[model samples]
Target: MTSFRVKSEGRFVAAGCALIALFALIGAPVIAQEANMLQAPAGMKPSGSVPESLKSDSSSATLAPADETGPRRIVPPGYGATTPSSGMPQAEEPAGPSQFFPAGKRASEPSVRMLSAVPGQDNSGIQIGTLTGVDASTAGLISEQQGGLGADMWQGASRADIDRYLSRLPVPVRSPVMNDLARRLLLTGAQPPEGASGGVSLLAIRLNRLIAAGQTQAALDLGAAAGNERSPAVAAGIARAALAQGDDRLACDALKDIPPGNDPAHDAMAAFSVKLSAYCQIAAGNTEIASLTLDLAREEGMDDALFYSLASEAAAGITLRAPEPNKLTIVDTAFYRLADRELPENAVEIVEPALLQSMLADPSVSDEMKVAAAERAAAYGLLDGRDLAAYYRKPSFTPEQMAGLLTSDIPESSSLRRAMIFQSIGMAAAADERIHLFKLAFATAESAGLYYPTVEALYPELDRMVPSDALRPLAPAAVRAFIAIGERSRAQDWLSLISSGGQMLGRDARELTGLMRVSGGSPQSFDSEKASAEIVSDLKSGVRATQLYAASEAMMLEALGFQLTPAVWDALLDARGALTGDVPPEALLNRLQASGQKNAIGETVLLSLDAIGQKGPGAVHPRASAQAVASLKAVNLESEARRLALEALMARSNAGRG
Candidate 1:
């Protein structure tokens, strides 16, 4: 018992090394030993150095609670803690980006995977390849806006958020804080230490402040220096802010600073910057700009999030906010298209927006194609969904009537030309309502480009024709959405939407067409055109195109699990060709497969082989089994046996005959 008492006292003496000598000099009250200290010391040898009696945790020796309550070992002014307490809460949440970081926080590792979702669970989307992105600008702005800015600087933060949560200095429109942080950033050299999170935090704070203060130059410098170190959210915000300011240059500069090595974030930043640049340039009236900003955004080749955003934007103008605006975002979906150039009668002043986006991205698309595509997109953009395919009800116009107003700048809409005009003409009719005719005629006459109808001019024409009732203009899905939302009315909205979409509605052929086989100007097989055709063919067979499109569209998606395959499309086409002497299945499949995609002709070959097997080895194609078996085997498909077996049964039916 006496030995146990002596050991407990020794631990208390050793517990407060820094405090021990000082307490004695102040003549402070002697500290009492607690039950916790009464246990065996950490790392004490089991080799019997200490008495076996002291090893037991049942020691009765204990110090009474201090009678003279002096300052505790580590207490606040009101804190009464002397010894560690027990039975505390088990689970605890740790402070992170929004909390305090340690000194040299820039070097401190941030938890890319946070535990905000649930206990013992994680949903960190952060990838090893995408780490080191900048978030300081965003973090600083968050602190500034939420009134938590002072908390960071005052109490210091962890190494995770941005290094040091300091206040950002204000800068101007052209200057970013790049110069200010340059020395410090350089002093740390190429690599930061483990706890340099403070530096990262300070850099972010400075960046956000400069951006808010309109110091674009400094922001640009900071962005460049940070390189691919910013987070996706941060890069996106900076790009957006730059664009909102109408400074395309700064936006582009900021985007370039995003490390090229970043995964989706860099691509996301690129998509935003490229789209904005194209729109801003066009807005400034660069009607004839012959380069490609929109194209780069499309094929940024990363950032799926950005891709969806851009596509959504492209569909926005025509299909603004209808429940399903995209349903009408097509030339065939337009009303009042012109027959000559294959435009909707309502289309006016939209030629440049459509045609120019592609020309700006890739200069090689034929002038004729650019003009046609632009017209289609513009027509779709201008259309009102309530009356999709309602052009037949619209009264027809005389050739002279059209030529009297036909302008030189009218751009052609590619495949959409025929469908859009056909739909428009279908909707034309001799409705006695004066407003109806006026709306159609007025829409027909206004031609700044592909998609525009002047209400002022059209109203008078309608009054001249029917001269009764009011005209109503409800665009096809998305187009109507824009009208209802007045999206085009606002300069900012127009710019934002335009920058957001320009290529969202583009035909895959447009993208693929650019990768031309120069020898004969054939579309590169891997382009959007082949994918669209194959996908469409699959859908036209009764399935909606969207479902089967997943195979060709999503790179990671598996081929359709259904028995049907793209070969079916080619085989049908081939049979149609062979029967009509138009295109043989074998010839067509072989050609189409080259640029269209694998398995494009797989089903066709399968059917052909099955037919051959039924013909008892005299199949027209003669090599169906080999073709089907080979392709199926490559995908680990066991359906090969089925194709061969089905052929055996067909042979008995004698399909070899007509």
Candidate 2:
């Protein structure tokens, strides 16, 4: 009985061991698949697990009484919070050796392996540094396509050199062509020169120069266009321009817009701002603030006696007999206007041309002073000819003055003479009488060196006169004036009248025709030999003045793309003896040529203007004129070149007549 029981227990134990082995064999593949899902592949770090802070606290868990809320859903660990299974297929597991190793089986080798080095890891061709300069050169009012010198206008030049050259440019450039060129260069939107960082900016210098040259409106427009109105220097210029134009409110507002602690680069600009602040404060009825501002200015080293006197007078409503200032600025002028003080007699002489427009509008100014200011302003292109014409129409003339205008003795004062003639031409009954009056007017203006201004003033009258055989006697003068003012169509009409007369061309008519051609008139053949011989014979005969003028005309013709014989150049050289002024240096000419060759448009224009100097083209040396024309043409400024040449010819003609 004992042996049978022992056998049964042993069998049971053996069966139990066999069952455990079967269960282990069945779970081996399932464990291997789970391990494959958890392990990261070669060359990749394992993704981070859920942070401890974000894990649920099982120890703090509590059971709440149930309500009618929706059923609580169960989510698996490490799932469903961020990435839920939508209906898309899961990514296939990385093909590699399984993390688990079954007994008696070696693990397969990993299909992916780590790389030794990454591609593009070399840094030999890379530059590592910080940029150190501020570039503000791209601010301008005009573009290259809008007649500006292009974005590359200052290439091949440094900021220091460009600033120096611009500083040396003549203010109120006398020649119209040079003036136009200077204005365009200053207003162009282009890149700044190299190393332009942290100083008085180029834009500020440009704005100051424009204001000094009586181009205040242009300076204001440029500052506005550049969106730099808040800069202290630019803001100061805008305020000054506003004062010059009698817009006190605008001036005050411009000053008010400047940010605090941003002082202007110029001491004069700082002083002007101080005075303006006081004046604006007074005008706004803040008397205490105005007085305090003035006190602060004095404490801060503003020593301008004129400004203090004017401000004191305005603030206290009392007049002070202050000594006259040696120089007057737009600020001083504004204060004077505010204080109701009569401007000094020499104000017209010392005042900048920019202030002349406001001066001309002042009713208290003498008629003579107004006329002088108008002439100077017109010459500088600050005022239109029609503006002077309006001033001329203000005075009334007696019937006798009008009747004897052509035959009577010319008035000694140029203003009265111009005014008299301007009036008489309007009332003249017959065309012949008007033509005589026109010739006298032009001759009088030419003698006084006011020919261009007179031409502008009388253009409407001349435009109304029909070109006919009867008016042929006045053709040369009419055509010359028309060409001087760029009225090419009118010049052509007068030139046709000269041709229609069917007479051999006289020296005056031939020369006038050549000038017309240079001013973009209809194309015509020129007789270079005849013109040169006439000038040469005149030179030999000691008619130096007339022939010198003729020589310049011939040179101008040749420079404007008209072919002239070598004899013409020889005659021009001989005629150079009559010129007594200093000629442009050879170095300047060389620089101009070099700039043109490099296509440095702004530099070329500046050097050309410097070569021309303060005098108009007519007064410059012919060599300078020739080189300027050539350089301008080389840079594709054909229109400017032609206009410059034409001006030279017209100046010579007018000078010869004088």
Candidate 3:
């Protein structure tokens, strides 16, 4: 009887174990099952010390200790719901462009927003040319027609009629528009009244006409004349005119006649004059006084956003305080905006980035104010694409603010600023977002005829981030950018990529690739004559702006890393139209040797051998100076090389010792 009982019990136990295993495999809620789910022998109690009902409730009700190792069931507030599989909620998506990826985006996407012609105003409708409605004769007629029927007719005339009658009104006229019309007319070449003595005021009007007529030199000469010499406004206007023409010396001299705090009766006019004086100071490299003059302008209530923003730029390395609201009145602010657009030379410097960032942070600043400040900063090179990216990195900003930055006025003619803004957008974007922005900046620059420096900023990141196929359209810009940044190998890499890509190359790209190939060759193999001719042709072609050609030549020369032979030097100088200058070769040499070129001192031993073959000991040839200096330094022959170079320079020039 006992043996039979044991066998039955073993079978029962085996069945119970199998049942638990089955529940585990099916992922059933067996742990939380009620007591009724299992049947116990009539006289047997549960195994756990606590009653099954109470124990089950206690396990579910009690919270886990902080350090306990188990699954955490409690989620803090706002963690809405967990995934059944993963048991953790997903992060919310960030707002803005990241949420929307435009489809079929080409490598060269177009973001054709106009750059502000004026620092803080619409570039449109602000004519630097002749006044639209009024000719010189009509202006004279308007000045002459002041008394009887004409005067009465003009008195009730609406602003539009005045505009219709006046021709090109230079600036917006405040009401009581006749005198304003009369002043503008006088300034636009209308003859002043016969008995009205042509003093400084009359000369001021004539100076304005001269400037309007594009006669900058004549206006400058007039300002220096006896009668006009004492007029601050005339001086300021002439200085402004001179600076616009790149005559910084003439501008500075003109400004000396109008000292800061030379307050005229009209505070607004005085403020305008003072701002011009500051620009002259900047052009003359008189940054200290420029800063002081800007301060005085603000103190006298010159709160034009352009003035302050530019003042901040000129005062780089100094912390500038923004003007009070009342000081920057709408009318005055509008005038400054007009001045910035009308006279870009006046505020050519960029506002400091840190100060601009502070302005962006201030809640009191209007979107328009921020936009104007940012645009001016960028146009003048105070801000860049990296700065733009920083602006976007913030957690919150209005769509209007983003739009304002993206569409801020850069001139269609300014490739540098356009390229810069485009690159800045790329710099601030995530890796996934960069490709489109980079291509857009490059494409826009090319479309607008701007071959720009900002391309250099995009080159190093191109290989990994940009696909091989998208590179063809970017070839010219890439070559130029790489060369400028002194990345000769990378520029070669671009050429290699394009050559191997099985795509047809553009003419400009082909030329650039050929140039790079020549540069990469041995010094003896370089065709200096042909290269110089090509450089001249490129300059004349104006594919890139003329001013940039010199820089390109400089880069090419540096990239070759060869000691320039006299023949080569002659060719380059001839191309530059600088061969006949009395300027010492030392100056040119100094410029070439400075940071960007980084020529490896041509093999020092080779230079010595050449010198030995050409000249006696210690007689370093003028053409060999570059290699001599670099090689000497490389082989610890620096002092001897220096001596040899100085001797050559002295032999080459009649320049007296400093």
- Per TM-score, the best of the predicted structures is 2
Query: Please, what are the lDDT tens digits per residue for candidate 2 over residues 1-658?
Result: 0000001111111111100112222234434234321122223221223222222243422110012233221100011111111222222222222211111111122122111111111221111111112133466655565456887888876566577668777767656667767777776777776754334557767877888778675665555555422456656676677677665555655553333221322466556656766666555554444555565565566676677677776666644445666677887777777665666766776777778877776666667667777877767756556777887787766778777765557555467778888888888878788778788788877766567767878988888888888888888888888787777777778877766357636666656755766677422566666655765665555566566566666655655556555565555556657643347776677677666666777877988888888766766776677667767877888878788877776766642131
Ranking by lDDT: 2, 3, 1
- Which residue ranges in model 2 land beyond 4 Å of their true spot? 1-136, 228-231, 253-270, 286-303, 324-327, 345-349, 360-373, 404-411, 447-449, 468-472, 487-507, 521-535, 538-541, 654-658
Q: Against the true structure, what is every candidate's RMSD?
A: 32.7, 35.3, 38.2
Against the hidden true structure, what lDDT does model 3 obtain? 0.35
Between prediction 2 and prediction 3, which has the larger TM-score? Answer: 2
Q: For every model shown, what is its TM-score relative to the native structure?
A: 0.19, 0.69, 0.29
Question: For candidate 3, lDDT tens digit of each residue in 1-658?
Answer: 0000001111111111100112322233533223211111123332223212122222231110033243221111011111111112223322111100011111121122221121111222111112223322222121222211121222212222222212332221111111122222333322222221212344455456445433343344334332222355555565555544444334444433443343422564556556554554443343454455555455455556545554445443322233323323222222232222221221222322223333454454444344444443342333443443333233333445434544656453353345345535644555434544555665554343222223433444554444256445555555545543345676666665555467635445445544453323555776666655554554455433331333233333433343333343333444444212122233223322321123212112222323222222223323334333434444443333333332222222211100
**Candidate 2 clashing pairs?**
none
In candidate 1, stretches whose alpha carbon ends up further than 4 angstroms from where it belongs are 1-194, 198-201, 209-239, 259-658
Worst lDDT 10-window in candidate 2: 1-10
Q: Please report the TM-score between candidate 3 and the true structure.
A: 0.29
RMSD of 2: 35.3
lDDT of each: 0.26, 0.60, 0.35
Residue 263 shift from truth in candidate 3, angstroms:
12
TM-score of 2: 0.69
Order the candidates by TM-score, highest first: 2, 3, 1
